[model samples]
Target: MVNATQVSFFTLSAYFDTGVFKYLYFIIIVSLYIVIICANLLLIVVICMNRSLHEPMYLFLVSLFVNELYGSTGLFPFLLVQILSDIHTVSAPFCFLQIYCVFAYAAIQFHNLSILSYDRYLAICYPLQYNTRMTSNKVSVLIALIWLFPFLAIAVLISLSVPLQLCGNIINTIYCDNYSIVKLACSDTRVNNIYGLIYTCLIVFGPLSLILYTYMKILKVCFSGSKQTRQKAVRTCTPHLASLINFSFGCLFQILQSRFDMSSVPMMLRNILSLYFLTCQPIFNPLMYGLQMSKIRSLCKSIIFGKTLTDA
Candidate 1:
């Protein structure tokens, strides 16, 4: 039987031997990172600088952008470095930190979407109470809890990972995922897997179900109103609904694949889907809001021209 020490050593050795393909993958990933950073930064700037965008919905959007920025930053740079360099190794402490950040950001994202859905639900179903219930203080507290709760969960998960002895050399995916890393262990992973599944279901599916149910109710409320009110409600909820759907779907595929064994899928196919999920959301978000919401498009254009005029 492969012992813990052997597993760790073997995994490290195999990781270092990945050749030219790693560098090529790194370049592609870096390009995607640049796009995600620039797009999200622009979105944040537009929301902040435009007085018109200083409303509840846009405020929630800014929060989403912030979450995505941290999420991508936490996961991508480390993967890029590993791909580009011969040093495909991470210390146990750093590994834990990485896992913590990745999972924390993911949880924050899940909660953010759920919050946004609830926000829309109130806006559509109880317009008069929306402002009072979703007061600035309330929103702030919710956002804080969303970020903080995830870190606590991650701490517990990391503790579970510490006792296991890892003895593998190959990471099947591009990055150091929790399951992928845990699989390297010589210890029985049944408990870890079970706990991981529970965590994922709570973090991913729980929020997702809430979002879906809230939106369904919101839609019913919309239809119950007059044509004008219905149209207005639909307009308000559409962007959020689209974004929520995209985020949930992307996360579902990413998380499920990350948790389960991926031995059956070809490496190339796995890499492609991984890249799609990782790169697509950040890029897709701004475009979706920009094209679908006229106010955002106007703000973006105004900012571009205003910058040009200032520079000239």
Candidate 2:
């Protein structure tokens, strides 16, 4: 039996022989990575350069855009290499690193969205006190915690998996996963399993609960307020809602595909579904927010065109 320390590499069993199509696959992935980097970078730059956008909402958006870059960078380059290589194997340490990046990315995304919902809640429900509540210092602290908590949590997770005595090292999926590694362990995994459940609740359910509560409060204010207030609520909340829903579905698809028996599903569809959250969400968020938010849209136009177009 190969133990964890003895295992030097893991073969990704999901990748098949694509023959000549491998080059085509490589080109498509490269294009996607370039787009993800450029779009997210543009948004981050736009938010940081404009003083009018130094408020809590745009600051949170900067964090969001930065994460899109972080998450995509972690996956895309590795994926591009794998697509072109005949042997789909990764070094053990690199595999663990990828797991850390993927898990931390997910945790940060949920926390960021939750913080955004709360920001919107304050802005719409208590416009008079929104500034007082979501001050610059507070926003900085929240963004810090948003990133710090996830890194620490996923650190603990990776630590638990790193020292295990592994019976096998072949991960059935295209990328390394903590649970997949845990399942390969020859040692006891009760603690790992238990901690994973707690981590899941903290990373997933906890933020979702906060998001739900904030939206409910926002909805109450919208119902009782004036037409102008209602319009404001709709205009501001629409992008956030769309982003939350889009990311939530992507996560849902990924989780279901990972945990459930997906053998009946076609290989191409399974591969696409597994990669949906990582690939699509990075691109989806910037486009969704960029076009829908008038301020961002106008600023992007000004930057790209050298003059602001009239807001229609």
Candidate 3:
């Protein structure tokens, strides 16, 4: 019965009364949030403070890690608050804000990964020319573009969504989702849908295409080159490839759960699946990169434990 303009808050029906179990949930989520923050921040610090880690690859990683922190912060605190509250309601403006944050986070992640792939492509395929192509200034600009493009793109999406006349105020999920809000609109949404499609092509498929192309090129180089070259490619590219695959799969899960009929599935499992990308990706990237990248692992050990192990 509520109009979109008049709707002050939206009900999130995903949450249920878990009684004392809420406390357990709260502890678990809070612990997760803390871990995400600390892990990402630790890597960021390790990258920034060490001059040895100031190369293009590590710089790109800093951007990626910072994004993990940004994306997780956008979701975890709000989720924590909602978990403890009896009524799961979020203000309209705040909901849209969350949508913006979440969307931008996703966009930035894809773009960042794309650029990282490009960096790898340069490093592996054209090692002699990498310094010339991926200069510090260029790296700075690429970093700027990754962050700027997503924030601006999501802003337009929010602007489009905010003016819609919604038929309902209830969001079925725990978090504010742009597609869900657009679906609630009683007003004409053709423009929104069109723009959304365009944004997806640009933000999602565009980067994915670039990533695929770069990897194929990298693979070609590895096959044609020496064993040392193959080892080098594997050493540098494995973590990035793993991170991309993991995040992409997580995104796929979220998309399937959101766009399709999942009512037959258990609600608890649905909630976990919905949150998988946001929760897992943040922690996943740091661990994958931290352990897999020898330089970072050695540097971390040196910083944490008073023993400076040489990079293997």
Candidate 4:
């Protein structure tokens, strides 16, 4: 093997214990990835084809579904190959690409959720104006912005990272991430660190705060109104709430993993927790929403089994 002085490839140290059963693990991982891809694509197609679902709520959902595919594609294909291989090394450019994709995925997830919450707020609190307010053109612009903001923000973040001089190239995680890559830099990464914190606040916590305020307003209006209104609010918001909680847990895992000392945590458990955001949220969001939302659920049933079932 021809050798160079600086690190050109990063050997992922997280897969150290995957010995004889790597093939079995590989199969399982590939199966899950396929499932996430199929589910997201199906829902996206359904939303797009049905004119009834072309409204702001479903449009936002379709955007999210697309992002799920975007995020999963970044990790799963590469991950499947790594699971079956002996040497788990990633080239430099590929690592940075993964960094961009994963960060953008997570950032956009929060933005999408925040947008959905805002839609619900307007719908429930000011139903008569919802149609006027959330026009098709306006929704289109919002959707474009939702995708573009993260793409640009993370692009800047990745560009800043591009100039870093690395002291090492071994990442201690199964997947490549911005912070993980930054930790290997030879020079002081305080700028990157500060930027990351600010970026996290802008993307994750900022959106979360807005969502909370929206929910509080929704709750206020629901409680002040009739029983029917309360029920309607609950029906529409429950699935969103479920998704928010699930995604929050995944985000929490990522934040904790990056910040805290996970040495005492079992390796298998750590791997699972680290993977939760990427592995679980993609499948969970659409599944939970599709089943809970009557229109999408019935549409799915009608298309799948040739007849829609009557609501009991």
Specify the highest-lDDT model's number.
3
In angstroms, how far off is 264's CA in candidate 2?
0.5
Better of 1 and 3 by TM-score: 3
Q: What's the TM-score of every candidate structure?
A: 0.85, 0.97, 0.97, 0.94
Worst 10 residues of 1 by lDDT: 7-16
Ranking by lDDT: 3, 2, 4, 1
lDDT of 1: 0.74
Better of 2 and 4 by TM-score: 2
Poorest stretch of ten by lDDT in candidate 4: 1-10
Segments in model 4 whose C-alpha atoms lie over 4 Å from true places: 1-5, 307-312
Candidates' lDDT values, in order?
Answer: 0.74, 0.90, 0.91, 0.87
Return the clash pairs for model 1, or none. 7-167, 7-168, 8-167, 11-168, 11-169
Model 3, 1-312: lDDT tens digits are 446779899999989999999999999999999999999998998888888888999999999999999999899999999999998999999999899889888899999999999999999999899899999899999999999988988999899999899888888898999888888888899999999999989999999999999999999999999999999999989999898988998889788876788899999998998898899999999999999998898888887887644433
**What TM-score does structure 1 among the candidates reach?**
0.85
Where does candidate 2 have its weakest 10-residue lDDT segment? 303-312
